[model samples]
Each structure stands twice: as structure tokens, then as C-alpha cells.
Target chain A: MKNRVRYTFILPALILMTIIVAFPIIYNLYMSLHIWFVASGSGPHWNGLKNYIALLSDKRFWNSIRVTIIFTVGALGSEVLIGVLLALFFNRQFKGKDIIKTIFLFPIAATPVAVALIWGMMYNYDLGIINVLLKAIGLPPLLWLADPKWVIPALIITDAWQWTPLILLIVLSNLESLPTDPFESAKVDGANSLQVILYITLPMVKPAIIVAAMIRSIDAIKTFDLIYVMTQGGPDIASENLNLYIFNMGFSYFRMGMASTLAIVLFTIVMAVNVFLAVIRNRDVT
Target chain B: MSKSYIKTGLFYIGIAAITILPLIVFLWMFLTGLKTQMDNLAIPPKIIFSPTLQNFKSVFAQNNFLKYLFNSFIVAVFAVAISLLFGLPAAYAIARFKMHKIGLTLLIARMIPFISYLIPWFIIFRKLRLVDTYIALITTHLIITLPFIIWIMVNFFENVPISLEEAARIDGCSYFQVFVRILIPVVRNGIFTSSVLGFIFSWNQFLFSLILSGNRTMTVPVAVFKFISYEEINWGGLAAAATTITLPPLILTLFIQKHMIKGLTSGAVKG
Candidate 1:
């Protein structure tokens, strides 16, 4: 009776998950193995490995992979570095600390689409605040989202602005929980603050940093709303990542099979990275 | 002593700078929302200007934004409420039974790219003639809210002392009775935290809504695009709409600031 009741307790949620979560994933896999286009008014026909074959040679697919890599590396790198630094700076007691921390939470809390819209306006060329500020500071304003060279960087800046705080919050919480003995011993050894931070604080918080990075990477690689709203993978598709590309294939073009293939690839990449990081985290623990 | 004082002063300045830097975009959005179109488009960008409610007026009066706001609210409420309903029991079972595999399954579901699900859902909903319905929107949004609620509440339920359950059992209380009359009251704060966070997430979700919801179920995030057209963009109206859409989550987060961090980090750190 006791054993059966536990399953009963979990039944509703498990049923809902299987229907909503598990079913769709299986359906997506099924779709990926077939050729179908909604616009053609034709049902799915089995065309195993062909969609995958086309994806292997598709130039646009490769471009999207490249763009995703650059965006992920750039955004995640800056976020982790700046976030860790901010966490360190904020570790000490200070005046108005809670208020300051609350202010930091605003970006994380705000709607992503709305956040993208505001950044879109700020990145405007002629009369945007960014350019106006640039001119005020005796610098020439350059095209931001319009220029291919600048689009990824501009997107990265906006991403960093909104998401860096997540890393900071995670790392800061880890830092607070850290043991004091190591730091006190390091101090007794006459190590400078920078040395202590470099050798002691950083190495100690390695697990938290890895976890933070893993979370950020997963979210960043699948970023769509910000890219779609701001650029629509435009300015010559310079900023189009896998998510946007898959969106175009599935929805805009109605190429369901191709889109499913792309999506499967993205899913594989995300899961691979997740497993890789979990391995590193486990290795560190043992 | 003077040198240390200067250092402290610089430290404060540094913290202030970093905090204010990101906030400037929001501040700019708010100020622009209050500006007249002429003032908004002015050269040198008017740092000081007589404000107007015209943008806000136009957003509601001209664009029918109230409908979208209603849609967003209804979807988020129903989604979070249902998640709580299903998630609470599952969370309790997972916590007490040490069902870590079920917990991991939910976590993987959360981690999957939403677009993968969107394709299959779009097709399925289209076949059922359920596209653009509240049912479709609410159901699709479960993918976001349900997993989150279970994860957070599982953590919350684990923290509850089992002795309390034993006490209730000894008093002839059944399992359901103990769970309801005893456990629910203890973790009411967890329920609040998960619900608020879950509501905010479902509220902010854009892609699923973008794909599944049509004109009848248009959400606030998708509605923000109405201010943009092919020829020109309504800067003031866009800002006004963006600012309005951002406020609910922003304000709710402020109320649960401490709990939000605990909720977010608990999954990653402890999982």
C-alpha cells in the first residue's frame, strides 16, 4: 500500500510530463526522419538520413553553427569573467548593499522581449542614446546592429548587460558559503589580496563557476527571442544562431523535416555540453 | 587612514557605476516613453523635456493593448496554478521517496530547446484546431512552469521534517491528510516562491506564445511588436509598451528578491 501510494502521488505530474514533454520529443524525432513541408499540402513521407545529409552540406547551416559558436564564446566568456569579478567586489560588506543588489536583479527579472526592444532602440543609429553619448564623449558613432561587423558584438553587449548578473548572483552566493579558514591561512602566509584571489578564492569557487557557466551556456546557445526580435537574423544573417535558423526553417518556410533535423542537432549539442559539464563537476567532487 | 578612506570611496564609486550602467537603458526607456515623438527623435537626445502621456494613451487607446495584457495574465495564472496543483504532490513524492531519476527527467525537460517542442505542438494543435486557443497556450506554457515548480518545491519539501509526518500518522491521519493538513501549511512559503517565479517565467515566455498564439491569444511580449512597422518604428510607443510589460515581473521580483536567488541557485547547486 505504501509503495503504490507513492506512484499515485507522482502519477498526475508524470502523466502530464509524458504527454506534454516526452511525447513532443519523440514526435520531433519521428518528424526528423521524414520529409515534409506544410506549404506543399502533403503529408510526411519517409526520407531517412536525407535531411541529415542536406544539413551536413548546407552552407547556411554551417554559418549558423559558426555564428552560434562566436556568440556563445563571446557572450559566455565576458559574462563569466565580469560576473566573477563583480561577485568578488561584492563579497565584502558595504553601505546600501541590499539596494544595490536589488538593482542588479532588475535585468534578470525584466521580460526578455521587452529587454530586447529597449536595447534595439538604444542601438539605433542616427538619434539613439548610444550614438548621442558617443558624440558627447568626442568619439565617432558607428552603425551598431546595422553593420555586419558590429552586429554580433552589439548582440553580445546586450546579452552581457542582461545575463551577467545571473552569474554574479550564483557566484556571489557560492562565495558567501565558502569556508573562512583558507582565506585566514592565506593571509597568515603574507599573500597579497590579488594573489589570494587568484590562487585561493578562484580555485575554491571552481565548482560554482563551472555550474554557472553550464547554465549560461545552455541558455545562451538556445537564445532566440532576443535575436529574432532585434535582428530577425538579419544584417546579412550575421547574428543568426541555430535557434533562429531552425525557426525560419520550420515556421517561416514550413520545411518541417529540415527544421526538425536542425533542432535535433541543436538538442544534441546542448545535451552533449550538459553531460560534459556534469562529468567535470563530478570529477571535481570525487 | 586617508588612503583607506579613498579606497573605500573608489569602491563605492565602482559599485555604483556597474549597477547604474545597465539601469541606464531602463531609465532611458522610461524617459522615452514619457517624451513626445519630436522630443524622442531630437538631436543630442533630450535629457530634459516636458513629458507627455500621449505614448501610453496611444498604446492602449489605439492598439488595444489591454486585450493582450489580459491574455498574458490569464495564461500565466492558469499555467502556474495548474503546475502547483500537479507539481505539489509530485514534489512531495519525489522528496519523501528519494526519486532522483524523476527529478532529473524534469530537469532535462526544462533544458531542452523550446523550439523543438514548438514544431510538434504547432502541428498537433493545428490538427486539433486548437491553435490560438487558451487551452493550447496554457498547455504549451506548462513546459516552462511545471518543471520549474516541481524542482523548487522538491527542494522545499525535502527540508520539511519527517517527524511531523510520523506524528500525523500516529494520530490516525491518512497519507493524504498528513500531506494536506500538515505538510502544505509548513511549505506555504515554498508554494508562494515557486508560484511567483513560475508565473514570472510563464509571463515572460515569448517563443511558444509567438508560435502557438494567434490574434485571439496574442500576448504582451508579442504585442510589443505592433509598435513596429515596415516603414518606421514608434519609438515612444514601443518604449511605453516595453516599460509596461516589464513592470509586473520587475515589481513581483522585488517582493521576493531573496527567495528568487535561493530558488534559482538551488536547482543548479544541489542538482
Candidate 2:
């Protein structure tokens, strides 16, 4: 009787999860296997593995894969490194630490579309404050967005700007949670600041660093708003991420079949990476 | 020593500026929103330009912007409400049962791209004739928010001493009543944090709203995107529009950011 009563509540929750999350994921996988298109309103014609084959042959698909990698790796690597350093600084007892933290949190929670627009304006070559400051310092003004070489860097910079506060939050919280006895023991052992940090601090925070990296990497690969808002993957496909590329294929040109295939590839990559992380994370747990 | 202090000072200041640039730009957008088009785009970008409410008038008066705001409110509200309604029992079960697989599935949901499901959802919603309905948008939004609520509340529920809930169950109170009255009283802040974070995520979500919503259901981001359709975009109007849409989230974060960060980094870093 006791077990049966408990099972009732779990059943409803299970049904809701299946309807909302599980069903859609299954449907997405099924859709990836077909040749569906926009507004056709007609039922999909099954073309087993054709979508996958076409995706393999498509050069633009490969180009987008390359771009997606650069975007994800570039954004994740920089954000975590810079985020830890910032988190450490913020953790230090300093004047205005709270206020600086408040300021730091602003970009992380602010609407992405809006932040993208603000950065878009700031990156304006002529009227933007960045170029003006550079010219005032007697430096030559470079085209921030119009130039191909500078575009992805600009996107990565903006992403790091908004999201480093995220990793910083995680690291700073873990830093605060560290027991004080370790530092005291390290000091007794005649360790300097750098050695203590290298030995005690970094290892202690290794779990957090990995966790932060996984979370950031997950979203980094799917970054759509900032890329779309800032560059629209422009200056000759300089910053076309998988999400934005899939978006363009589906809606912009109405290639839903191809778009679904891209999504499948993206899903596979995310799962593969997530599996790798889970294994490492699981081992850490054990 | 003084030279090293100067170097450290320079480096710290540089990092601070980089971190603060987006906020400064946001302020500039707000200021520009209050200025005329010509002044907004002036070569020097006038800091002292004459302020005007013309853009606000156009935003509110012309764009039917209030409707979009209302839509955001409605979608975010119901979606968050529903996520809580369904997620509570599951989170409680997960916490109580130590159900790692269920928790892991929700975790993977967080990591999956929204586009992976978009293709099918658009099809299903369209076929159901539910496109442009708040119901369609909100329920679909649950994909993003439900997991968030469950994930955050898992910690909150875990934090509660089992004895309190167990004692209630042993008493005359039914399990449901214990959940409603006793357990809820303890986890109010957790509920608030999850609900608010969920609200913010649903409110700011773009791609779902893009395909799911028609003109009547258009969101702030989609509305902002439409301004660029013409060969010519009114720079002042666009900036003003962006500023208008950015304000609510900014103000929400300004107050609730501590919790927002807590929610963002919850399980990622084991603090």
C-alpha cells in the first residue's frame, strides 16, 4: 500500500515529462530521417538516410561545422580562463567587491537580444565609442565588424563579456566554500602564494572548472542570438555557428529537410561530447 | 614596489573596463533613445544631445509594443507556473528517491540545443492549429524551464530535513497536504528562485517565438528583427527599440541577480 501510494504521484510527473520533453526529442530524431520542407503541409516522404548522405556531400555543411567548432572552442576556452581569474579577483577582500559583482552580473542576466544590439552599436566603426577612443589615442581605426578577420573575434569577445561572469559565479562560490584549514597548513609548510594556489586551490577547484567548462561548452555550441544579432554570420561566413546555420537553412531558405539533418549532426556532436564529460565527471564522483 | 603596484593597477582597471563595457553601451543606448535621430548618429556621437521622448512615443504608439510586452508576460507567467506545478512532485521524488537517471535526463535536456526539437515542434504545433497561441508557446517553453525548476529545486528539496516531511506524513496530513502546506513553507525561497529564473528564460527565448508566433503573437526580439526588413533601418528607432525591450530584464536582474547567478551555476560548480 505504501509503495503503491508513492508510485501514483510519480506517474503523473512521468507522463508530463514524456509529453513535453521525451516526445519532442523522439519526433526530432524521426524528422531528421525524412525529406520534409517548408509549408508543404504535406506529410513527410520517408527517405532513409538520404538527408544524412546529402549533408555529408554539402560543403556549406562542413564550413558550418568548422565555424561551429571555432565558435564553441573559442568562446568556451577564453570564458573559463578569464572567468576563473575574475572570480578569484572578485573573491578577494576588496573595496566595492559587492558592487563590482552586481555590475558583473548585469551582462549575464540581461536579455541576449538586447545585449547583442548594444554591442552592435558599440562596434560601429565610425560612431562607436571603441574606434573613437582608439583614434584619440593616435591609433589607426580598424573596421570592427565589416572586416572578416575581426568578426568572429568580435563575437567571441562579446560572448566572453556576457558569460564569463557565469563561470566566475561558479568558481567564486566554490572558492568561498573551501575549508580554511588547508591554507593554514600550506602556510605552515612554507609554501608561497603561487605554490599554494597551484597545489591547493587549482586542484580543489578542478571539479568546478570541469563542470563550468561542460555547461559553457554546451551553450557555446548552440549560440544563436549573439551571432545572429551582431554579425548574421557575415563577411563571407566568418561566424556561422551550427544553430544560426540551421536556422538559416530552415527558415531563411525553407530547407527544413537539410535543416533537420544539420540539427541531427549537432545533436550527435553534443551527445558525444556530453558522454565524454559524463564519463570524466562520473569517474570523479566515484 | 610602486612600479609593480602601478602595473597591477593598470591591469585591474583594464579588466574592469572590459567587464563593464556592455553596461556602458546599454546606458549609451538609453541615452541615445532619449535623443533625436540626427543627434544619435552624429559623427562624434553626442553625449550632450538634446533629449526627446519621440522614440518612446513611436515605440509605444506605433509598434503596438504593449501587445508584445503583454505576450511576453503571459507566456512567461503561464509557462513558469506550469513548470512549477508539474516539476515540484518530480523534484521531490527525485530528491527523495535519489533518482539519478531522471535527474540526469533533465540535465541532458539543459545541454541539448533548442533547434534539435524546433523542427518537430513547429510541425506539431502547426498541425494542431496551435500556432500563435499562448498555450503552444508556453508549453513548448516548458522544455527549457521545467528542467531548470526541477534542477534548482532539487537542491532546495535536498536541503530540507527529511524528518520534517516524514513527521508530517506520519501525522493525519496526507502526502499531498504535507507537500502543499509544510514542505512549501520551508522552500519558498527556492520556489521563488526557480520561478523567477524560469520566467526570465521563457521571457527572453527567441527561436520558439519566432516560428510559433504570428504578427499577433510576435515577441520583443522578433518585433525588433522586423525593423531591419527594409533596405533602410532607422538607427535611432532601432536603438530605442532595443533599449525599450532591454529594460525589464535589466531591472529584474538588477534586483534578482544574486539568485539568477546562483541558479545559473547551481549544479555546475559544487559549492
**Best-fitting candidate, scored by lDDT:** 1
lDDT of 2 by residue, B1-271 (tens): 9999997798679667755765676777788678887886688768787788898788788778889988888889998888888888778877877876778777777777898778778877877998998878887898989888888888888899999988988888887898889988898888988887788888788888888888788888877776655412466777788888777776777666567766776755431
lDDT of 1 by residue, A24-73 (tens): 99999999999999999989999998999988889999999999999999
TM-score for all models, in order of appearance: 0.98, 0.93
Report the C-alpha displacement of residue B81, candidate 1, in angstroms: 0.5
Candidate 1 Cα deviation (angstroms), residue B30:
0.2
Scanning candidate 1 chain B in windows of ten residues, the lowest lDDT window is B225-234
Candidate 1 wrongly placed segments (more than 4 Å): none
Query: What are the Cα lDDT values of the candidates?
Result: 0.90, 0.80
Please give the lDDT score at residue B96 for candidate 1. 98
In terms of docking quality, model 2 is: medium
Candidate 2: tens digits of C-alpha lDDT, residues A1-286: 5466556656676787788778878887777787776666777778889888987788888888988898788899899998898776666665666677777777776778877877787788878777888888999887877887888888888898888877888888789889999999999999999898889998888788788888888888889988887888887777787888899988888667778878878878887876787678767767
